[model samples]
Target: MKGPPMPAPLSRREFIATSAAAATLATIPVVHAGGSDLLRVGLIGCGRRGTGAATQALHADRNVRLVAMGDAFEDRLEESLATLLRDKEVADKVDVKKENRFVGFDACEKVLASGVDVVLLTTPPHFRPLHLEAAVKAGKHIFAEKPVAVDAPGVRSVLESCELARKKNLSVVSGLCLRYDWGFRETVKRLHDGAIGKIVALRANDYRGSNWGKARQKGWTDMEYQMRNWYNFTWLSGDFNVEQHVHFLDVCAWVMKDRYPTSAMGLGGRQARTGPEFGHIYDHFSVVYEYDDGTQLISNCRQQPGCKNNISGHVYGAKGH
Candidate 1:
């Protein structure tokens, strides 16, 4: 039996326009060329990464303003806005009003309807699919962070949203920065240009200490606590592999000419941080990915502290490594 039919290949315009880039909210040139004067941005998450993205967006262009902000918690939303206000360079561009400050689970929907041209989906991986669909439906450009989804179903949803965005001529850039880094881009280009010859095997590693986590406060419910400490739960963050190590995996795929692995077998478990506060995610993962061309990608990532950090990847080819 034959497999399912493939979609038509993306044209050069679609490829260039929809390709994920580093600058999330700095696409004012496109917006301006498309006959827009100002770029209004809405931030859906208020954590460190979200705040940083917002700051970058504000600094990217003078015609850009943060018109809306949303988060699951009011305090986080307030803190993010205050942080933006304190930034002297981008302070004047921060114009989020009181009514535009949305809090609670439905904050994303409200932000999308707040007369914004761009929306940053910086929430946890679990909420990404829902928020992205809403953004695309509202005809807003998107800057979704890495690990777009926590599970396969969410990934499918995100793909559908991206397709819709493409059809609408809207840009959807990802949080994957490796694609934008000049150094990495040049290196990958050389590798693809036969600098490494016929590549055979690859190795990637991301060994580091635990990321931030918070103890449950007094009045917070289980749901609230999980949302606050999202990184610890696989349902929220997709574990360290999807949440953090996706960069390395992406690098591996880029080296392989964008050919993803076919399958893999792996085992992971919590070693150092086994407390209940850490949730149910494993602290380490080791997997070997097998591609259709017989290439293998050995990947590993860990979150235990003081375990000799090593964050690098290498591709071995026939002519040279």
Candidate 2:
């Protein structure tokens, strides 16, 4: 199947009007069916985010228990479990035993098959499509992190999984926290009420730093090194644009009535983040996305250190901003 193309440096416009997001939470309340008064939860990709997500879920409901955990690295899985078990807030809700902790690329599938009613897919974006597909097939409700896929093929897989989840009456909650922010919600609501009049121009920035990567260890192959420092690689992390700047991009899409841009032209480069340890991701990017009606959304993202930082969006309208 044909997929969305990477933004090429062309004077011509290119249409990419599909939704630039993953499946959001179901409007209907998600009901758990593991057992009476208990929600068996599993966590895959046991990283900082994975641990945090599991903690949040446990805190969200007393009946929820984290029963399984998995990660591509055993160290990651162990550290996450150790941290979660040490935390006072939701420590009691974690029930992952040695047998239930899996490691390797197929670890997520093991967690899904562990008879958990709910699964938190906090894996890297490259692994998300595969994990989601497995979780849905296993009849588990999902709590997935944002930037669900790294490429068009992965996105396609996620879309198919979302459809399958819907048919199976499963809930799919993404980690797009902006959607739940009251301030953003109110602003969007008022914009619809003509507070911003007609939104004629959109601008956003994701200027920040600390896109860090570890130096390769002495006894590691390229595969081992890249897996440990996935964030710096395009294949694993989709570069910073998709991995980090997707937040602003998704917000822009949301503000534009959840419709994607008709076309885009962009330029970006490695710049100061140019080193073997940092892998191959560009440190800065600037893209201008055009809608069907010719309105434009311009975006800029930079990850170099010492740069003045800002994470903000603006909607300029004919009447007001």
Candidate 3:
């Protein structure tokens, strides 16, 4: 006997329109309407952000259930599960049995095969491309976090996976939260509506202090320590530029009507955090991106401690100051 018919893939125009309209939290699940009423959601990272995304997913729809979880470290997975269980709002929705709790490097694969309709890809940016491809191939809806990859190749892989997901009629939502924020949306809309005429230049900056670091234990290998403190490693977190400053870059792109940059020159260095424990990622970055129309985006980001903190962006136009 034949199973249910597959849904028609969205046209390019339809996909663009749907993505734009569903930029906010209220409309995220609207794309998954074709799924079963009771959606079985899986968490793949089990970190702080992973746990938070799982919580949000549970709250996004009443019928959604957290059925499976995976993480490289068993402790992280168990910690996240316990935290979810304690939350009154989504506690009842958490039903990850012991068998469904997977650990180690292959945990993502295990979670994908455990009968989940949706999966949250909150692993480090390094693992995102691999996990995204697997999820798309497995025909599961995905909610992937920002800076989906560590390098150009990884980014290309994510693009390919997204296109394939489109062909499969699977919903793939990104974690660029600014796009979903009401205030930022309104502001960007006004800019695009000519509140600022003929944009000429923009400035984006994200300056902050050092992030948390875990000291290496006696028996931990290099791989174990780096994995535990993934944010400090270039291969894992993709540095603060791709990992954290991506939000500002996204905003710049939005203001430019999604135009691609023609060329860019950047300067960065590791000054404050030079210890071995901090890995090899740079602490600061400044880049100037030029568009074909001569519009420029000057961006800067830093992760140093005990310094003045400033995070803001500005757009310059012919009619505005």
Candidate 4:
């Protein structure tokens, strides 16, 4: 029997075009800063994810200040700066001097050069590898959101970068927030202590909400807007399964103490949100992952409205002890 055909590779031009477009749509306006003597923090992307992350980082420590920001679009950088300075919680924590705001492709470089100790990489998955590589090279601790890469090539790059991060003793944490949750940790600990004697299989599910949707706006090129709203693109978001449900997949992997799955067979499609702007991502998916020891991990995810937010998983053991 023959195997499934591989996806066609994206040309360099296609990649650049999509990235450029997304950068423009997602740009935020910048705000002016107040002072110095603050622990400088740089944000590489200014989307909702990036803004939320900046707020959290500020709240995490008093010394930390959002000293610099970078985005492909000037508008996004400015908008993000304005929001941060306006939010009562974030405003007090940010120092948005003219010298601290940066815009354009090279803005990331400038932010790093400005003496940032920690960097937040919340760019689209397609651009994550590049941003992560730069942060690692600059010897800065990093907080990168989930779905680190969009494709096999990008994943390989991230793994290699992860290696360098370990060597540098940099605290490189993925945005898999569940790993930090107390309730989840308690359950995992019991299982490890023989609460489940010799695990055999596991199953996980994430069925909630509708896929991404965007309204048209002026000065936004198709490529730029496409990149700005990347959750719908496979090459940028790595498919809904990998992008959103990977948290459950990662949980199963963590419990089993494994990295790669032995083999996988799955099905996916676009049951809803079928539009030109919506690229080649499946709105629903089911995958079965088999481990070397014959243990199996089944994962399913769907993005349809009116569905309850139910994310749960269970591990089965031989003895059921």
Which sections of candidate 1 miss by over 4 Å?
1-24, 27-36
Candidate 1, overall lDDT?
A: 0.86
**What is the C-alpha lDDT profile of model 1 across 1-321, one tens digit per residue?**
243343444432343366343444444442332325677889999889899999988877667889999999999999999999999999998999999999999999999999998888899989999999999999888889988998999989999998888788788888988776667877888898999789999999999998777888899899999999999988999998999999989999888877888899998998898887888889999999999989999999999987899999998999988
Model 2 over residues 1-321: C-alpha lDDT tens digits? Answer: 243342333210111111222333222123443556577889998888888888887776556788999998999999999999899888988899899999998888788888898788887789899989998898888888988999999999999998988777777788988876667777877887888787898998999985788899998888989989999989999999999888888888888888888899999998788878899889999999999988899999999988899999989999988
Error of 3 at 119 (Å): 0.4
- Per-model TM against the reference: 0.91, 0.89, 0.90, 0.84
- lDDT against the true structure, per candidate, is 0.86, 0.82, 0.86, 0.75
Better of 2 and 3 by TM-score: 3
Instruction: Rank the candidate models, highest TM-score first.
Output: 1, 3, 2, 4
Error of 3 at 123 (Å): 0.6
lDDT of 3 by residue, 151-208 (tens): 9999999999988888887778889988866677778888999997999999999999
lDDT of 4 by residue, 190-251 (tens): 78787879988899999887876665578988787777677877777887888889898888
Lowest summed lDDT across 10 adjacent residues in model 4 is found at 20-29
